[model samples]
Target: MDRRAFLTAKKSKQPASVKPLPLEGRTSTGLAVYTGAWTKSEITHLLKRTMFGARIDDINYFAAKTMGEAVDELLNPVAALPNPPLKDYDGVTGAATPDNDVANGATWINSVNNDGTIQSRRRASFKKWWMGCLLQQDRSIREKMTLFWHNHFATETVDVSNANLLYKHANLLRTKALGNFKQLVRDITLDPAMLVYLNGRSNTATAPDENYARELQELFTLGKENNPNYTEADVKAAAKILTGWRVDTTVNTFPSYFTSSRHDATTKTFSSFYNNTTVTGRTGTTAGDLELDDLLNMIFAKNVEVSRFMAKKLYRFFVHYDIDAAADANVIEPLALILRTNNWDIKPALTTLFKSEHFFDVLNRGAMIKSPIDHAVALCREWEVVFPTAAAEYADTYGMWNYIMSVAANNQQSIGDPPNVAGWPAYYQVPQYYELWVNTDTLPKRNQFSDLMIGNGYTRNGKKIVIDAVAFTKKLSNPGDPNELINELFEILFQIPLSQQVKDQLKKDFLLTGQDSDYYWTNAWNIYIASPVTANYNVVNTRLRGLFKYCMNLAEYQLA
Candidate 1:
């Protein structure tokens, strides 16, 4: 626990290279593995993509089940992991009463800018809550999809400053992350946080603002890349169709409201791009909901691009960024058809893709680089690091949130604070795509974080949280076997193809200490297991930490 223990720990003597395994079905678990023949590596790959990182017990449990069963378990999120409540109460008064005017909007602007206030502290707590969820949330892959949707329907806390609204907005995404796509669009369109973020709050029939409408088609539904399906006319029509909705910033909750007075009572028509669709606007209290439904029906039912666009975006997010000619025909195009046929439900496409033969392609294992959240969370999960937890029971969770957010920001993927409406460039952007996550600027910071977590451990407010290397390595099915530890840790830590020679060298140099005898490691491990207070456990722990730190610094470790 002492910092001196870290500085005195043994260090890796030499760096080793572990090449990525090619896309070939050599071993039973290698590339071309069918649904039934699930390999350890294949299971690891599934967890890495779905669970952010795989827990040892999860890997062992799912590895025994058929691929179908595994996929089914992932699709059905566990009901046990409830959303952490916003238990945030700032001693400040709620905003003034709503007058069907922009008073609430002005009040929000002031609160979003304050630094030394409970509002700001509450927002930070809100983000920390989600990050803690990432650490401890059930491994049903729901959180992964929630994160995907977060980026897809991106909103930052800086703009939507209210923690209650932010909490509502996020829970909306989690509840229906795998649900129907149209419902999410409608819900987000009227969400108070979203309305404010995209200037939907300012939109009125008299002077319609096209901010939300443009993004609805451009960024959310039909992507702007090479698509000409929606025009500026459609955005204006949508804006007119979406008017009269206002956020009542009065009272404790600034809920959205429909104002019939400001509503555009006339019929709004779309251009030929949308198949000449028409949303006949109404003036009643339900006008906003009715017209918004009409607009979604027009986009989803009338035009087919929405399904394909959403499918493609999800494919890129979950799988490889580069969909070549072959993959376009084989993967993306077919996946789009699945999306359309399934009525835009996310589960079908995800089920088909994760279980498909192409997903298990060995070369695809380390194809995408891990985002900052993914990288940090993976290390924590794999190392079995006991977090101070969301409650900060034993550690400074507030400080942990700031630390994680700072690392993500430095790495260009700030969690609750995306740069703009487009979310993190790692999810989108060209050529580089995920490669942008690690460049000259972010790579060192990521490496430094791993070093700190493993070396000195992370400390906040004088409380230390370190990965118990001895405890973790002992969790292995066979800790005494040097060769087993080497290979197994590779499966747990990195997804790349680890060479046998490299594995042997790692065992010899680190675990075996150049001894050819397997009993050397076995005996040392036995002594540690019997009396861990002895020098034997200390040696084992030091070697394991040194090797882990070395692996974390390797280039292969950067990729999922």
Candidate 2:
């Protein structure tokens, strides 16, 4: 009984009774309050929550919108930018050109030859393009989703240094970012980077590596602890079934093919839990490829396991982590049903989750803390601050853009690479993710970055870019009514209502600034805009420094 026969039989079998909930009702935990309008504070909170931080343009854009409109836009963003064409890695014409000899001097001089130089150039180009996407791309959701999948797939550069291999993997993720989950999984299993990362490069009949096979079941498909659907026997059997896949480095491209000679031509068997199948005599010239496909079919054939596992992970990533058995039966089960019904179409499943009433529940709001990448990207977007241009002229220049990447790297939040195959540990724990993202060290760094942004120490090139406090204040139509202004600001900053005490405190702080209402509001805006004042700058530098110190010290800075 091979994997295919096993899976086909499993699908036909009926599952146990499990009562599912309505797609719109609250979880077992109960419902959250429905705040009427989104304010500046709310926009700020939203920016902090959904993205890295607020950019000036993003803040203004949300500030002008109503609550329903803002939520709608976030759920179904129209501004997503298309992925740019990837440069070839073969050093053929139109491939990403090598940096100057001077740039490659140290690494190349120490290495054996041109191979090292080419690899170095490819690495540099890859990093630049990835970072560029963060700074300049208009599509926020695609980038966000890319990051999500990157963690989920968890491939590393150590296995495949060929730029083409990495780029191909990345392109696949971009293309299928919001597509079908089944296809995405199938596509990833064949990716060259993934093949190399998981030791599938040498998976063959003589010696099979269980690395990829085990992880596919335990990590990617069905999680370990919550759902122990597959056993050790299943893993060993799957490994034998998966042998024979290999990379064609001659092309220096991705989507590696199968080498028939290397495939294991033996039958495999699983435990009684897996329907007690004796998968045998299935091997042929196309054994490896067919066996792998058969294995996936068998896995998906167990609809209950995939459904429960995916729902839990998706809930942790997109909603709350805490799971009640009743809620799982209701929300998770129903969403899983959609996936099963639609052959695992990811977009529809996600769309269903977003539109579901439970998504907007107050309890789900502010449940997740901003990951480091989210925090950084949101700041750039909300402030509308222009990052470094990627032209040939200033390729060596270093400042905030460099600093931003450095900070991210330091915080163990590199965009392209995660800590391991498992992904960021904090995201797995649920509500504790809020506490997990920050600690004594990271909290201060977060504040320091905020202060740098609000103070005059920060700059683009050599020129001082003013945040235009007056312009921000003038955007408000009702300067006379402090409460209205605060409410309006909150609408721009966060998508949730501010408590009366928080509003009053902000109002009192604005009044103490000694400027007129409009002036004071504008000044505060300026402080947030022109942060990180360096010594020996301009006149506004001192004021910006003082204001930044005060603002970063505030507890509100940590919330978003």
Model 2 Cα RMSD, 1 decimal: 9.6
Which candidate tops lDDT?
A: 1
For candidate 2, write residues 74-170 as lDDT tens digits.
6454665544422223343333534243232122212212254466556555654665566665523466667778888887654567655777788
Model 1 residue 393 CA deviation in Å: 1.6
lDDT of each: 0.75, 0.60
Error of 2 at 516 (Å): 9.2
Tens-place lDDT digits, model 1, residues 37-144:
477787889989988798898899998888878988999986665545433333344523221221311223223322335556567767767777777768698889
The window of 10 residues in a row where model 1 has the poorest summed lDDT is 24-33
Query: Which number leads on TM-score?
Result: 1
Evaluate model 1: give its TM-score.
0.87
Residue-level lDDT for 439 in candidate 2:
76
- TM-score per prediction, in order, is 0.87, 0.77
